[model samples]
Structure formats: structure tokens, C-alpha cells
Target: MHYAFDADQETFRRELATFAQKVLAPHYQPDDRAGRMRPELPREMASMGLTGLRVPERFGGQEADAVTTGLAAEEVSRADINACYILLVAALNADILVGNASEEQLARWLPPIADGSALSALVLTEPEHGSDAANLSLRAQPDGAGWRLTGEKTSISMGMLADTGIVFARTGGSGARGVSAFYVDLHDDRISRTALDDHGGRAIGRASLHFDSVPVGRDELIGQEGAGFVSVMQGFDYSRAVIGLMCVGIAEAALDDALDYARTREAFGGPIGRNQGVAFPLVEQATRLAGARHICYEALWRKDQGLDHTVAANMAKWFAPKTAGEVVHQALLTFGHAGWGSDSPQGQRLRDVMAFEIADGTAQVAKLVVARHLLGRKFAP
Candidate 1:
């Protein structure tokens, strides 16, 4: 029945909001201009425990719940949406590691991430297989007791900067069952990276990762071979909610800026806030953002409660980013000429938010998931 953050949660939210504005926001534009990730960004995030939101405390992590993880992502994203990709990918990988990794494996793998010595990327999408990830063509040839992965993964978030990644590859026959996941060392000389000339989210270091016979020890195999795709898919459901909140945060930031401008900027005789045409659209955007944000939080809440949240998460995945794109574009228009310039973060926000509509899961793919959930697997697409 309660519809607000508890006292501790509110405090945490405020702390993160301050940290983000003071530490992260300043670099948001600078990093974009440089077209690269700031080396210090991950270290600063780790100091705040943003990098370890889902990791176990015993392993030097905060061990935060899904709702809190989503909350952290939202607050951090308000200052820098591209930076939130680090949070999203790390959280998703952490959950996977926590659920499927053995104690020894956890000991070996997690502390570095918690302490921010290592950055993680999800090596799932391929040049030929994006949404069709089940049919990924990456080859994992058995070599001695381990495997050697060889293929290309394109449009990977943080691919260029990550010291390690969970690389999915085919180990058996064709289709999803043949696939296996490995938490491999990405820093190996066998792997070559090519950074994408991105239009948006430039700081995320999206790139194409080419694995050239990179060796993976048997110990690095995540869970059982052929079980990788299913495990990753399950972890991804919760991350969709996190991605939704990320969209909400950026759009909310844009709307606040536009509102401030509307109140202060004089037009004709007085403030533009006087005009219904200008005021109403902002009103509608705010309302839409609120609704989308609520669904996102609700999905994460369901996750924390151990309830099936696929439907809500998928819905949030589809709606929030799409709503954010519309909202940011509208907010940009509200800024008049000021929003059009390179100096304006509004345009950057628009481009960054557009990536969400395609990354993780595309809007169309998310709709299909919700459709299956609502219409029954037998009836749905």
C-alpha cells in the first residue's frame, strides 16, 4: 500500500544524487567530446559502491537488493546516462555470477569487480546475430580441458574498456542448446577490439570484440555447458527494469532543465511558462515519465520479492526508453535554439536515449516477450 521510499532508502537516494551531480555530471559532456570513457569514472563509481550493487558483501560487495540496484542506477543516470551502462552491465553480470558461479569461482572473479579493479561487459550480440542471440556463431572449440573461443561480438557495451567479460559461444550443435558462456579474460592478446564510432553513449565504449583463439580454462565455464543461454536470459529480465529506470532518470533531468528554462526565459512579454502550448507538452512528458518510472520500479520490486516479473520488466523495457526518447526530443524543442547546439546536453541525451531503444533488447523484442506472457506461450508470437 505504501508508495514511497523508506527513510534509509531516501537517504541513500539523496547521497547518490549528490555524489552523481558532484562527481559524475561534470565529466558527462567532456567524456562525450573525447569520444572515450574516462578512466577514473569506474574507480569513482566503485568508491560509492555503485559498481558492486549486486555483489555479495562477503566478497567485498554491497550485496544490494534488486530494487536498490535499480534505484542506484536511476540516480546515477540522472547525472550521466551513459555512465549508467557500467552499472547495468555489471549488475547483470554480478547476478549471473552470483546465481551460477561456485564459491571458488566467486572468490576468484568477484572481488576485483567490487573493488573496481576490473570492468565487465556482456559479450552476447554478434555481427550477424543480435536479437537472435540463440543462434550466435561464435566457435568455442574444445582445447585440452578448456575451450578456445573465436568469432566477433559487435555493438558490445564497454567492450573496449572491460578487463573481462562473459563471452558466449557455441560448443555443441546448432541452436540455443549448443551455446555456452565463459567468464573470460578480455585483456588477452588473442582478443582484438575495435571501438564503434558511436553517435550516442560515446563514453560507454561500445565496440566489436574479436576473439582469436582466446583460451578459456575449464574453471571459467559459467554453470554447465549449454545452460549458459538460459541463465543469462533469466538475469537479463531484471536488468530490463534497471534499463527502464535509466531512461526515466535522463528524461526527468531533461524535463527539469526545460521547466527551469520555461520559468526564467522571457518570450514576447513574459516567461514561456505562460504559454499553454509550451507548458502542456512538458506536463504530458512529465506524466509519461512518471508512469514509465513507476512500472520500472514495480518490476524491480517484484524481482526483490522473488515473484515472476518478466511481464512488467519487458513492458518497462519497451515503454521507458521509447517514452524517454519522445520526452527528451520534446524537451530539446522546448529549449528553442539553445537545445540545437553541440553545447546542449539535450541533443546528447536524445541520442543516448535512442540507443536504449535498440540496446539490451529492442522495443519490438520486448513487446514480443510481453505478448507471450499475456497471450500464453502457445498463442503469442
Candidate 2:
């Protein structure tokens, strides 16, 4: 397997990094402090053909593969983790809708998504079901000519701001096989949203959605009925890789900031970095960051090549976010009081990376996936 990126991918990465540095990094601090979404950023991303990285060129996307998408995500996230979150949701939503939506549905949804005129949110996790998404309790009952949905979804990223939502609800009897995916317009009269007052990741605008008998037509069904759970799971198989890469980017940023501070910050007649206590943790951060990057890249590579990467993806998802959290914490500690200051970049980095541990999938859930894969059904509970 080729471990190195091709020239085109490298060029794409460099361009993305340059764009982030110029456009995102400068505004991230101010926008985040105000808890505001960068409205102009999405338009810029679409103009650069980033919103639809994985969608077919016919659908106005670049049609890049998994590895390219992961690389782009890493660079975008390194600049502003919140933007990366938005990009991932857009890319993953496009991937799912394009892969599963009917021709008419695609005609209706894909162009808007590709052009960045609209944003989509994945509503899989319910108020009760998170990692256990298959156990969804949201009910979608058959109505006169369509269906009516009633449920509450919590912690939905971009939910408050999205124009459309890919919602999963139960249509059949019970269990995962009964669940169906529907593309519901968020503007419907029966739907309402409340933004969560979260401590971290506030820039991404996580929210709870309340759907009270929201009407949906047959065209809203993505793929087949009872296949929503599997479709979402398949989507996660790739999205989690992107999430892992995001963690890597956050950690890389933290490490870079810490190393820069170490070189300039003086203590005991010299830079504190001269002392092993401060230097050693930085060393460990570098080592872990390298490992997480390798795992994430390898997982993405395997995906692009059509290889089975459930195990590698889960391992990366589990390890990368946890490693990023550790590295960011270490970076904060390296700065001492400066890191604790609200105005400090390291302080913001710490909060941003903390969200990675929970987004997409929590660290605990990722470990369980890895354990289940390695041990089969014999794995302990």
C-alpha cells in the first residue's frame, strides 16, 4: 500500500492549509469568543469546491476519494476546528445522500448541498439513544399519503442552522431493522429547534430538535425502508475517519503552539524547554501525534483502496481523540498560568479538542467497537 500522498493530494493539502491560514485562523478567535458561526466561510468553501469533496463531479462536487477528503479535513480542522466540523458534516451528508437518495431526491437535494446554498444535519442520536443508535425510539407512522414523525433529538450538530436534516425514525415493528432514514425539511411547521448552551464546541451550534408529527413524503425515504441504521453505520465507517483526522489536526495545532511557546518562554535564566520536565511532555505529545496521524492516514488510505478498515478506523477514532485531548492538556500545562487565561490560544485549543473526544463517537464507544471487532461475539460486555 502507498503510504505517501500523491502529488495532486499534496498540492490540495497545501492549498487548503494556505486558505485556512489566510481566511480562517485570523477570524477564529473573535468568532469563537462571540459564539458566532462564520456565515461567509461556507460560501468561500463552496467557491473552492470543498463542500462537495466526495460527491460526483456530475453533482457539482470534486469527486475526491476518502484519503483526499481526510487530508483536506485535517488541514481545514487544523486552522479552525469548528470549520472542520461544518465541512465534515457537509461532506458526509453529501456522501450519504448521493449514495442512497433516489434520482428525484438527488435532483432535489444534491445541487443545493453541493453549491453550499443549503446545509444538512444528520439526526441519528436521540435524546435516549446515542452510541446505541439502532435502538431509536423516534416513531414515523404512516399517514394519508405520507408519514408523520414525532421525537426529540439532542446534541445534534448544526441542527439549529441546517436547512435540511437526514432524520432516522422507526417505521417498522421494532429494533434496528425497523428504522428508516428520511430527509426532512427543517422549515416544516411541525419542527422546532433549541440551541444547547454547551461549554465547548459552541461555535458549531449543537442543538436539540423537536419534531411533532412532521410530515414527510415517500420521496423523503433514502435508500430502502429499514435500511437507515445500516446506511448511517456505513456512513460513520468513513465519517469517523474524518473525525479522527480532525483530532489529529487539533493536536498538531496544540503541539505547534506549545513548541513555539517553549522556545520563546524563559525560565531559570533560560527557556523552560531547556529543562526536561517541560521538554519531555512536548516530546511525548510529538510521539503520540505522529502515531495518531499515521493511524488516521492509514485508515483513510485503506478506505480509498476499498479495503476493510472497520478495525483500523475504530482504533484511530478511539486513540486519536483521546491522544489529542492528552496532548492539548499537556500543552496547556506547559504554558502554566498563560494557558489558563481565557484569552490564551492554548486555552481555546484545550476546549476545542475536548469536543473531539465526544463528537462523532465518544472514546468509550470507539473502544467498544475495536474490542468487538478483535474478539468477535466472545468479547466481554
For lDDT, the strongest prediction is 1
Instruction: Residues 1-381, candidate 2: write the lDDT tens digits.
Output: 456889999999998999989988886678778887877777888876778887788877898999998988889878888887767988888888877888778878878777888888898888889988888899998998778999899899887788898999999987889999999899887898998877667777799999999989888999999999888878887888888898888778888888998999998899988999999989988998899988887888888888988878888888888888899899888888998988877777778777877888887888888888778857835
Model 1 C-alpha lDDT per residue in residues 298-373, reported as the tens digit of each score: 9999998899999999999999999999999999999999999989999999989999989988999999899898
Q: List the residue pairs that clash in candidate 1.
A: none
Mind sharing the TM-score for model 1?
Answer: 0.98
Instruction: Summing lDDT over every window of 10 consecutive residues in candidate 1, give the lowest-scoring window.
Output: 372-381
For all candidates in order, the CA lDDT equals 0.92, 0.85
Error of 1 at 51 (Å): 0.5
Say which candidate scores most in TM-score. Answer: 1
lDDT of 1 at 355: 93
Q: What's the TM-score of every candidate structure?
A: 0.98, 0.97
Candidate 2 — worst ten consecutive residues by lDDT sum? 372-381
Query: Which stretches of model 1 miss by more than 4 angstroms?
Result: none
Model 2 score (lDDT): 0.85
